[model samples]
Target: MKILKLEIKQKPFDDILSGKKYFERREIKPSNVIDYVSFIVDGKEYEKEEDVPEGDSEVMVKAKSYDRLKLVTGEYKGKRPYLMVEVKDAHVEFLYDENGDFIVGVEKGKEYAIAHIVFELGNVVEIFKGEK
Candidate 1:
């Protein structure tokens, strides 16, 4: 079968890395999984907590903290698929602020919201606005 690949942009710490450039593409499989080659399974210290939004029971993750994300085998549309990822453990830790709620990590009074998304291939897609 033909492989479908999805292209997503990634931004890393500029100072820590050599240079910022376009990230690689993950090979998509019939199962809807996209296997990424950039990430590695380095068992690191990760954290996990319940991310309960107001009046919500879907406990999505909040943050990955300082852990290396893992890439696990998952199913996509009933087929074994892969995904390009950042955090790939069975569960991830969410970064919290003093209030105990999931922090957006943006400066106060900002007009943006932080969102954490988990894709089918065990990737934590984090969208942050502004600086912490």
Candidate 2:
């Protein structure tokens, strides 16, 4: 199973840990065009729309199958606090401008959205406080 590690802030982390947040969303950066907005799994990059595997999820961007999401409190270290949780689903959404219209463009190649990434939250596998 592919495990995606992400450094998250405190409030959101707490919400996820407490079962308040059901999914996590990441805004696509301007620096990364649609083609570049992707996830690297096992040395392979899932960048294209057809590349990410979808399991019957109705999302603008098909959800990639990630087994676990390793969330870190801050910079990842040898013994830092981390939360490993089962990833129920993952997907990407398009970007909308101030007018609410869909914002699409070509950068290096054809692409979609500003890149809204959605990773559905699942059961918590492990939570390490990082205290030694």
Candidate 3:
């Protein structure tokens, strides 16, 4: 399995940890070869997505919830992945704001346009809190 590291803020992080948010929507899609990915939250390793296991109820839930989707974005880098996801199923389509522009990030009342990326997270695979 190929592991990718993502830097996320507190709100989205909390949403993911609480199971309130499942998909990590981004303007850029990962390489089609990636099979599994991981995120570090408070020093804990959370497995966002993994290969579809035949008889695993947990994995089944994820597989059933998400369909193979993709969208195009700005320039991006491609690397080898463990599993190959189709380009069409890996891209992220963005919704335009009222100004007919994509909002990348927001602070105060100002919005910014920038590239973004998403990742579908799974269960916690490892924990590294309070370790040296």
Candidate 4:
């Protein structure tokens, strides 16, 4: 399955392990934001090969987003905690400014720093005891 590996911290990790946290948040950065699995804009083809089309619009990321999410935490009690969760669905939200509007920056009419991808976590399929 397609897995998205993420490094998590202690506090949140404990919450997730205890089933207190239900969702995981990750910002859409260049290193992670690549070609879309399948997304359209304004009822038109948004070009899957391209990152995003020019205009003020939003699209839902699907399929290739990831079938599973791998969360890893650094050394804790001489062991790194690692958890693999099934990603049921993912939601994408465009960032806004102080005025609470979508921030579509300049660089070829793209928004690199203005989007958030939240993973709706499902069951914890696997848990691995990481090395110290």
> In every candidate, how many clashes are there?
11, 3, 14, 0
lDDT of 4 by residue, 1-88 (tens): 7888888997887788788998888766544565323466766544353656776887555434688888988865676778989888
Ranking by lDDT: 4, 2, 3, 1
TM-score of each: 0.20, 0.64, 0.33, 0.68
Worst 10 residues of 2 by lDDT: 30-39
Error of 4 at 18 (Å): 0.5
How accurate locally is residue 114 in candidate 1, as Cα lDDT from 0 to 100?
35
Could you tell which candidate, 1 or 3, scores higher by TM-score? 3
lDDT, candidate 3, equals: 0.39
lDDT of 4 at 115: 68
* Residue-by-residue lDDT tens digits, candidate 1, 1-132: 222233232233221122232222232221221121111223222131212223423332222222333222332335333332342232223446788875553344442223323322223343222221
For residue 33, give model 1's deviation from the true position in Å. Answer: 14
Alpha-carbon runs more than 4 Å astray in model 2: 30-61, 75-78, 98-100, 104-112
In candidate 4, position 25 carries an lDDT of: 80
**Candidate 4 deviant stretches above 4 angstroms:** 35-64, 75-79, 98-100, 104-113
* By TM-score: ranked, best first: 4, 2, 3, 1
Relative to the unseen true structure, what is the C-alpha lDDT of residue 49 in candidate 1, on a scale of 0 to 100? 22
